[model samples]
Target: MKDDKQLEQTEKDKRQKAIIEMIQTGKYRRQSAIVDELINQDFTAVQGTVSRDMREMKIVEGKDGSSCITTEPLQDMHRNELQRLLRENHPPITKILLFTT
Candidate 1:
């Protein structure tokens, strides 16, 4: 018989795997939707659990409004790199237009 801790871990692992599979389907656009699907699949999970799972799975939002699962989190390092690239490439805006006459 599996102990409580072991059982919990096993369940969590299973849920994580299922979450990945669901994301791969590309049918869910929101975390709540994922949770709903899990429920439909007979997996009892709350929104918080789904949200945490998404974070743990390194899920990111795509430009086309689709959710994508990545191997890395959107950490400060990536954010800093993006900021640096944007700053280096984009010109600074100097003029502010006043519409009031």
Candidate 2:
């Protein structure tokens, strides 16, 4: 049997995963929307919980004004490298492209 802390962590993990999925779907634009979707999916989520989850997940608004997860350290390194290359070889880069399916 799981302890209370363990159970709470499990639920938080599940909720955070759902948040990532909803954001990836490109249908949710705001934290309130995410909270609503979580409630619809039978997950208990409040504004404060969602906010904390997003912060822990390192989620950020993309250039296109969409929420995205920045948890990929490798991808971040590559992006930084690409930006450095562009800055050294060409003009100052204004935008970085993110391809999502």
Best of the candidates, TM-score: 2
What tens-digit string does per-residue lDDT give for candidate 2 at 24-95? 788998999999999999999999999888877788877777787776733544565576467557875689
For 1-101, candidate 1 gives per-residue lDDT tens digits of 54798667657656777777777888888778889988998888999998887777677778886788675543533554576568668877999888986
Pick out the ten consecutive residues of candidate 1 with the lowest summed lDDT.
Answer: 72-81
Score every model by TM-score.
0.63, 0.66
Runs with alpha carbons beyond 4 Å of true place in candidate 1 = 72-101
The TM-score obtained by model 2 is: 0.66
**TM-score quality measure for candidate 1:** 0.63
